[model samples]
Target: MTIWTAIFLLLGGVGGGLLSSIASMASLASYPVLLAVGIPPVYANVTNDAALIWTSIGSTISSTKELKGHWKETWFFTIFTVLGSIMGCILLLSFPSSVFEKAVPFFITFSGIMILVSGKHNTLNTEKQPTWLRIVYLGTLLIMGAYTGYFGAAGGVIVLVILTYITNEKFIVINAIKNVISGFANLVALIIFMFTSHIYWLQAIPLAIGMFIGGYIGPAILRRVPEKPVRIFIATLAFVQSAYFFYTAYLR
Candidate 1:
């Protein structure tokens, strides 16, 4: 890649990482950049997964403070997430290029709406989480993890929502645990992708560096900004992207 292309990928990683810390959908920003830079769609997707693996390292460290004493709480969920991610990675590599090509826009649109509507509530207020609910959560995580392993734009957001429903934990703690475990899920999938896929190393290296920088910025910004406006802004952006995805996927 040229120096300019490298620079763009770097910035894309930074943006992707920062956005990831907040709500997940960050890949939406970087994937297009990869395509624009001449990476084929499948290669761009795989390379994005490769680069995004590191973005979680820093974010997970920061979230650990809030996750203290929460080991048992997270164990089962983590297992499901890891298993799901592995399944997803396998599915990803198995698919024809045309499959992912047709699926991408739909995935984006679905994930976007999920983040937007789910953002409205801060927590699940119901008394007991029914066994059925946990089943739904498990099934959802598995599918989402596979998708995340394949194309992780808003994986964190999905985790956050599921956790919110499962427990009465503080939002901060829930979010922190979400980061660490999701990191694990992505890490597992990323390693698998590294061996099996055509990772755009030239692109991934710079983007990973940018993600490291951006991860730091994201939490700091969230601390300073009030919650409502931030949610509004993020939700709005997600909605717009969702609309775009819908248009691109099924419409045209």
Candidate 2:
């Protein structure tokens, strides 16, 4: 790769990292950059996954303070996330991409609406959710895990929205968990991809470096922002992006 391409990817990674930390949409930044630099769509997606492992690492380290005391509660979901991720990887390798590609709009739209509605529910009501609600929540996470493992554009927003309903923790705290769990799910996929030839190490190296730096910087910015505004902003972005994806997938 040329030095200019490397520099462009590094900058993209940095932007992606910042957006990821704030809105969990790092792929929005890095994926397009990969395509612009001449990587094909499939390779770009896999290479993005490979490089994003570092975003998780960087975010996890930066969010250590927020993650404390939540590990016990998070462990159970983490297991399911790992399982879902593995399942997603199998599906990706074994099935036609169109199967999932067609579903992306619905997934994004549903997730965006959920986030918007969840904002209306009071987080302070500590009463245990009904059994059905619990089941639905777990199911959502499992599905989200699989999605993240397979094609994780805006996956973090979905995870963050579901987390808001299940836990009363501060948004930043929930976001921290979102980072770890999403990172974990992606990590499983990355490891699986590592054994394959799809990864472009040349592009991945600079992207990873950029994401690492961005991840670390993301939380610092998050701390300064008000929670409600950030949530609304992210949900709005998700909806807009969802529409764009739908247009490209169906109408275009």
For candidate 1, the TM-score is 0.84
How would you encode candidate 1's per-residue C-alpha lDDT over 38-157 as one tens digit per residue? 999878887877777667776766556666798787776788889888987878777753455456655555554554566577557646667887788778877777767765655676
Inter-residue clash pairs, candidate 1: 25-154, 88-146
lDDT of 2 at 177: 88
lDDT of 2 by residue, 128-207 (tens): 77878877888889888888877776888988888888788888888888888888898899899888648889999999
Please report how far candidate 1 places residue 182 from its true position, in Å.
2.4
Q: Which residue ranges in model 2 land beyond 4 Å of their true spot?
A: 123-127
The Cα error of candidate 2 at residue 87, in Å, is 0.8
Instruction: Give the C-alpha lDDT of model 2.
Output: 0.85
**Candidate 2 at residue 219, lDDT?**
88
